[model samples]
Target: MPDSTPRAPVLQMPQVVVDMKLPQIRELATQLRFAPEEGRIWMDERRMVLVHSDTFADLREELLASLGYEMTRGLLTRIYFAAGQRDAASVLKRLGPGASLKEVLNTGGRMHALQGYLLPEHVGRGLAAGDLRSDDYYGEALWKDSLEDEAHVARHGVGQHAVCWNAVGYCSGYLSYCAQRTIVVREVECRASGGNHCKIVAQPAAQWDNVEEDLRFLLPQPVGRRARIVAPVADGGPTTALAQSAVTDSRDDDRAAPRSLAETAFVGASTAFSVLRHKIDRVAPTQATVLLLGESGVGKSLIARQVHRRSQRAQAQLIEVNCAAIPEALVESELFGVERGAFSGASQARAGRFEAAHGGTLFLDEVATLSPTTQGKLLRVLQSGALERLGSNQTRVTDVRVIAATNEDLKQAVRQGRFREDLYFRLNVFPVVVPPLRERRDDIPLLVQALLQRFAPLHGRGHVGITSRALQALIHHDWPGNIRELENVIERAVIMLHEGEMLDLQHLSYADDTLSTPSYFGLDDTGQLMINTDYDFGASQSPASTSAASPAALDMNRLADDLLRQGPGQLAAMERALVRSAVRQAGGNITRAAALLGLSRAQTEYRYRKQQSAPG
Candidate 1:
């Protein structure tokens, strides 16, 4: 029995305008500037580090020549797939959320050409008038301009359909994000296969006739943890192919987060995560049923989709069934199709989740909550890939790879006689355990960076990162709710900040509410902003009451009185506060912080030293 969830509303695209010409490639390339400044590289407001083409090309050649076609292609696909997602997000952000479909498609395609990937030629008429590219004008990719194709041909002879696997994955990922649906692209013609140039077509998943076969190439293959440069062959045989060797820092290509993570709010990389990641890689390409064991908020559904992406069903939809969310009475009719007049309210024959997920993956989240009767029906479908409509005896054959996830221990349920033992064993052919966030602490930094990148663009409050001290505070806490909890915290922090203020976390609330412990960013002695977590703050402790009991409140009043008496900071008090706050926010670093205040390091140090000497 499959759980039923309401489907997402399909997005309607804009009606196409005649002869639409987007921003030319030349103008877009001009905006793509590379310059290093302020101890970091800058591409406009975004922080970026520069890389030369030869350096990248050299690495690409080595990876392909040494790792063989399968290993290299899978590795590169994952890397660029992530890059495509981030690029699409940035493009959409720049274009504004409400831009018309034609604007997004035309500009996105032009950006692809400008980025030196493939030259996308307009296919059919123009932008299709829906969430999907219509049959009239599906997207097309021309191969003559692909940098990757040229690089491959220069070293390895053209031998196959299309050697540009990375670009195909990249285009597919970018367009999919734009369409708000899963779109797959594949090479139909290629220069590598002795054609004049490489050419490919893109379509929404429903439009693909042979999606099951195409899904295999999209699976996340296990890539090397690191890569090293094998010096180019002195014999001039284009001997730069990457062979496995000592580990190097070549894996920093993580854009946003790894695309293999799939539609998740967060991702992490740590030894604790390796077990599940390895299991996903090994089982994704196979037909074996997988049971994901994890705690709530551990991202089980996203991991399930990742397995689908890497399996033979990438071209099909990943239908999710939230068992606990569905009504108990409707479970039967929802899992199997319902015929017209099957029940009092059955108006027409309708397909269920099983029918919808034909030739794809069906993810049953929280499968442990399933009732005993539903469990038996699910077992029947698992044993024989055939099912019947609720009111009809006619049977239908379906091909779906089932992946079930649960936060509960199914073994305990079976022993308690609440769950069937046979069904449990059938679903447990391959089990992958997902570790909680507390166990994978090493991945916090990467997760934070990735989360900030996503949240910053939406709220415009993450131009600068939090202080290391704040980061330490985040890492030290044990996350009971896991990644979902972390996401909420980051969002709250973003909302609290104003534009142009760097994120300097001063307070943290492990609990859902921080009402009693209101966050106040105060500076401490030694010119450093200190995080005062233990302070009690609320309406009860408001300033009106504090005048009677708090020395700090008394001091502030006295300073105000002094300012009023002597007239507007006659004591030079506010200036001192500003200096101290600057130093504190800089994490007690003197010189760098002094610069933030537009003062020379030596001058500020000299004035502070003189003040100390003159003190009584």
Candidate 2:
């Protein structure tokens, strides 16, 4: 009687990349940029506008009243489904090249968090590294703080059905785009239906028992409410996998779209970049000698490339020479062609950079470092496109457009007699001053994204996100070494990160002076000078707190003393008592009590309920 029956074995979930590391929450916030002066808010390249939650609730209530529940659900689901598809495309484009399939899939959750939809936690495993296109693929996730559920519950009270219709549609569309197959993500449990939190399960459409029921909402019109089936029926025809293969085979002539040069090479959307671009365009078509002035590592070379690309001679070769890198004795031969036996070690005749760049462009970087003798030769080439080969006075006629760049002041060099004034005038026909990285702080996020895409694959880190603190640090730092220094820091940080880890502040290596923490001096209530280290100031003060002493400030030292006096094992009891007192002070209003306790309403309610149930 005790033991003849066999027990069913517990089902095990399939393993996937559950430990997907995300960018720090703070870092995600930095992606949203406010430009009140320009009357715009931007999240990456996309424009965004903030809308009140109550406004959304109003819309939802109106829709429910007008269209009825089923129609409203279908309408909202299809709308959000389309939005999710766009989000998928934008996110994939933003992550850029070298991003792994896992990163692309994992970032979908981050995208939800970024848009204030919900926070997704994988229940057992994530589908980040799994085969998303598989017919039997299944993914389970728990959603906390779902905005749609909260809105629905607030407007309509507790619903009889799971009410996260938007989330379901969004996840379905997003996953479908990423997997290139119809993925039906159903909200199995929702707070509006009296569940603790929203829980969702996703599977390829064909694998779901009620796939038609789930996808019917995605169809248009009144038919969506009455339709029993949708396209790609669960039981008939070829599977999504076979269909995808057929499509792929038929699209052999289709190619990936070309990326913009500005997005890939000269990534920036700042006003400063726009102005620079305008200047480059103005002079790029002309034969005027261009001078690029900027600090070292400020991407003068990239500016030069942009100019060359936009020029009439773009079809020909572009020869670049770093004048400072060559020896002073070899500068003349490097600029002007050299014949055999021109120098003691000269063996064979070779064309100089100018001859090599015939009917093309010759970019001279750090041109200020060229010797006076070499400057004369450069002036001759710029004046008449004529140059003499060293040790052979045969003047070589060549047609070339010169684009010179330098970190040093060429005018000052001319004044100092290190460079010829005539040559300086010739090179200064159209001077383009590239702004430093610090001057255009708004462009930092774009640059960081580009750098991450470039360096992550080189170090085999796949796609690494940066912590919020790290991004804040990058934004605040005055990049004295300019873009080049930023490149080194990003590449080094990528190298330091292990697989499945985000780049953090600790991984960054900056100049000692740049990394130094400065002390702050402020006047306290009595106008007496008060000094605080940044650490103390930031740790002690909240963003809402003013310079004056705040009554709500926590006396950490006193609290610790009291805690020590109470000894161990009393922390939980004290917390319960504190929560209970806060509830009483707020007259049992959980929302007000949560504010008093500096906790969320849900948290305060949970604790108060727990305390009331505990035995005394």
Candidate 3:
């Protein structure tokens, strides 16, 4: 059985005696570049010097030279050294009878000057390896050896021991030592491996700033600090003429504010909106192409307009193009003007969007939808700042600011080969991402009020106020369609409401009903589709029974097998069936159809479009 008893604590020793070995002492003397005759060793309670008689004067001179002071009477002392296994017993044997051991030990072990030595090759190798394990091991060994010496001193009740080193330690030991409360000695580094030579660093126990200043003085001067200043100002107040000139300069700056893009831009108080505003203001004046990114209905076009309005070419026309709305066949001709005889429909010459907006700004909305050929032309225009009209050899030089906006992730599109990488980067010089309305819901009330005022007159209704309950509901509803959806809702409510009427729950439409229920639609345990009919679809069949037959009941594992058995139109028929069932169960209400399918109105509409686009 192993012993479970705790080990006894060992006494810690000072490092002075451990560091006084012949080899280490000699190394220190060599580092200091001192002659052998100039130094002496003492061992009798550290009071008696072991020096040759001829070198006594040399020893005294060396001591004075190293310490920057002369050694006088009482400076040297005798110390006791033990002769046996135990340090206490050895000290008693070394000190002769009638000699006061305590007095000798108390006055021994004092040196005016101290130095540390290290090899550069070892340090460099350790650093190059990226790990300082070897260096740390060396430092720990030195510290442990010194500690043993300290223990020996305590056992004998002799003089105290001190350990010192140069800035170069086994690794970071020097820095660790400096972090401690007590500093034992001065550290120095010998940069002999390189052009740097041995240098002394005297680190005192206190006043670290002075040590830093000393290091600064030793290092070579930096170029920046060494550079001379050509201009100097006298300490005096500016003359009256100079003050008047400064006032005139201030007026001129004010007059020049209108010419700057940033000066005319709007500032928002909200952090996200303010950052967007600042980014727009900063990038507006530059000719660099700008990309505006955001979700649908986030006012990306408004930001693009701001970019064009504040730009240097604001005086020229601002041409707008919607890539998603334009037919793929006409996109190329629409971008680069078509010649009269270029195609059957071209009876007259017409300038393209880019040509019309030359020397101004060209705003491309839904830019991700641009065809590959048009994208190539756009890339050329960005790279060369020149474009050739269709069926024309003449290349027209354009000074147009290109600001493109997209609801889709263009980088992802680029990776998918749906967009050109070179064109994406060219137009992405400055990207301004507009925050979704849901993210900045605090602006919802302000936006609603503004829209209410704008649309009330058109709807032939006086100002309609929203009830507190209605406003709270609006805030809670996740406006997936964003501000555009909010505008449409307010407009519909205003048309239905009488003048001075407050909008209530009847006027509001909430989108969170389907999102709030987890069982409505999600994957089940077997990776099969699951649906809950408890949601208000007004279905004739009970929710529990209907849910069992819904898509959620279909096994996805068998989907491939099922697809092989069915025709190509089977998937389309399934989707149509689902939509028809949802709409019928909701009594043909599209809003309830959206809720039954757990989709937003816009998403439902998009799905409808996809169904129409599907092949028969």
For candidate 1, write residues 350-453 as lDDT tens digits: 99899999999999999998899889988988989889888889999888889999999899999999899999999999999988887876557556655665
Listed per candidate, the RMSD to the true structure in angstroms reads 22.3, 16.9, 31.0
- What residue runs in model 1 are displaced by over 4 Å at the alpha carbon? 1-266, 461-464, 507-511, 514-616
Error of 3 at 473 (Å): 1.5
* Worst 10 contiguous positions by lDDT, candidate 1: 241-250
> What tens digits encode model 2's per-residue C-alpha lDDT throughout 217-289?
8645423321211123221111332221121111110221323433343655567876787898899988888
User: Which residue pairs in model 2 clash with each other?
Assistant: 27-468
Which candidate tops TM-score?
2
> Which model is ahead, 1 or 3, in terms of TM-score?
1
Give each model's clash number.
7, 1, 22
The C-alpha TM-scores of every prediction are 0.47, 0.51, 0.41
Off by over 4 Å in 2: 1-264, 513-539, 542-616
Q: Can you tell me which runs of candidate 3 are displaced by over 4 Å?
A: 1-269, 510-616
Number of the predicted model whose lDDT against the real structure is largest: 2
